[model samples]
Target: MKTEKEKMLAGEAYLATDPQLTADRRQAKKACQLINQGDYDDEAGRNAQLAALINFQGSFYVEPPLYVDYGYNILVGDNFYANHGLTILDGARVVMGKNVFIAPNVVISTAGHPLDKVRRAAGEEFVKPITLGDDVWLGAHVTLCPGVTIGNNVVVGAGSVVVHDLPDNSVCVGTPARPVKSLA
Candidate 1:
C-alpha cells in the first residue's frame, strides 16, 4: 500500500514539474494580475481570463486576485463565483460544483503535513481531495480542511472551520463545522 507521505510527494512533484501545471500556473498568475488590477469586467473577457486557472468544465465565474498553489489540481463547474482573496492550496484534487459562491478570504486546502514529530520535522506530506457540491455558499473566512466534502446547496457561515462532511442542503457553522439545520 502507498503511504500517505509517498502519495503526497508524488502528487506534489507532479504538480510542481508537469508541463500542464506550469502552463496553468502561468495562467493563474496572469489572471491574478488582471483581476487585482481591475481589468476584464466584461463577461466574455472575464471568462476568457479565468479559463486558464482551473479545469472549468461548465460555466463559472470568479472575482479578482484569485490565488492558488498548484492550480492544475482544481476543477470547477458552472456558475461558480468566488470573491476576493480566494485561495486554494490544491496539493490534491479540489472539485467545486455548479452555482457555488465563496466569499472573501475563503480557503480550500487539500494539503497537510505529518502529525508525527519526526515526519513533521522532515516535512512529510499528506493530501486529500476536497469537494464542494452544487449551489454551495461559503461565507467569509471559511476554511475547508483536507478531504472534506460540502454537499449541494449547503451554506457555511463566516469564520467556520470545516473539518468534516456536510450533507446536502445543510447549514453548517462553528469551528468543527457541525450541521445546525437542514434545508432539504
Candidate 2:
C-alpha cells in the first residue's frame, strides 16, 4: 500500500485531500507566503525560507508572488531566475536545469484530473513531471503542461501553452507550442 505522497510521485491517481499531502501543501504555502511578504532588501530571509522548501543548486533569484503545491517536488539548478506570478503545481517533480529563466505569470503544472467525470468528481488526479533543460527561457504568461520537456537553449514565446517536448535551440510559440524559429 502506497501513501498519497508516494502515489502522487509515482504518477498514479491519488486523492489530494490526504492528511499528509494536506500538511505538505500547507507548509509549501507558508514558505511561499514568507518569501512573498519578505522585505525586498532582506534577500537572506527570503532565500532562507526558499532554501527550506526547494532543492536549488548554486545561485537562484525568484521574484515575489510565487506559488507551489509541494516545494519539495521542485528542483532548480544554478542561475535560475523567475519573475513575478510564477505558479508551479508540482504534484510531481519539476526540474529546471542551469541558467533557466522564467518571465511573469507563468504556470507550470504537473497535476491534472482525469477526463472521466466520475473520476474527476471523486477528486482522482495524476501527475507527470515537467523538465526544463539548461539555458531555457519561458516568456510571460506561458503555461507548461504535464510531461513536457523543454530542450536546452530553447526560448518559448509569450502567451504560449506548451503541451509537448520542444527541441533544443528553437523558438516556440502558439497554443500547442510548436517551434517557429531554429537557432541551431
Candidate 3:
C-alpha cells in the first residue's frame, strides 16, 4: 500500500488530514515563521531557514511572509528572486530553473481538490507538479495552477491565472493566461 505522502506525490487521491502530511506542513510553517521573524539584514539566517524548509539550490532571495506545504517538494535553481507574499502548495513537486523572478503575492499550487463535492468534503486531494524554466518572470498576484509548465524567457502579466502550459519566449496575460506575443 502506498503511504499518504507517496500517494500525494504520485498525483493520486489522498487524505490531507493524514498525520505525516500534517506534521510536514507544521514543520514548514514553523520554518516560515522563523524566517518571517528574522531581520531583513540577516541574509544568512533567512537563507538557512529557507534551506531547511525546502529543496532550495544555488543562489536565491525570497522576501518573506512566504508560505508552503511540504516544502521538501519544492526545488528552485540559481538566481531566483521572489518578492513578498509568496505561497507554494507543493504537495507534488515544484521545479524552477535559473533566473526565475517572482513578484509579490504570487502563488504556485500543486494540490487540487476533487471536483466531486462529496470527495472534496471528505478531504481527498490530488497533486500535480509545476515547472518553470530559466529566465521566467511572474508579475505580481500571478497564480500558477497545478500542472502548469512555463517555458524559458516567458513573462506572465500581473493578476494572470496560468491554467495551461505556456510556450517558450512568450508573453502571457489575463485570466486563463493566453500567449499575447512571442519573443522569438
Output the number of the lDDT-best candidate.
2
> Estimated TM-score per prediction?
0.81, 0.98, 0.98
lDDT of 3 at 44: 94
lDDT assessment of candidate 1: 0.80
Give the root-mean-square deviation of each candidate in angstroms.
4.0, 0.7, 0.7
Q: Estimate the TM-score for candidate 3.
A: 0.98
Candidates arranged by TM-score, highest first? 2, 3, 1
Q: Tens digits of per-residue lDDT for model 1 on 1-184?
A: 6544345536542224445545655776776676567655576766676676579988676777788866678889887778888999887899988889999999998877767788666655567899999999999999999889999999999999999999998999999988999998
Name the runs in model 3 displaced over 4 angstroms. none
* lDDT by residue for model 2 (1-184), tens: 9998899988899999899999999989988988998898999888888888899997998899899999999999999999999999999999999999999999999999999999999988899999999999999999999999999999999999999999999999999999999999
Clashes of each: 2, 0, 0
Q: Write the per-residue lDDT of candidate 3 for residues 1-184, one digit (tens) a residue.
A: 9999889888899999999999989988988988998899999989988988877779999998899987899999999999999999999999999999999999999989999999999999989999999999999999999999999999999999999999999999999999999999
**What's the lDDT for candidate 3?**
0.94
Candidate 2 lDDT at 117 equals: 98
The alpha-carbon lDDT assigned to residue 162 of candidate 2 equals: 95
Clashing pairs in 3: none
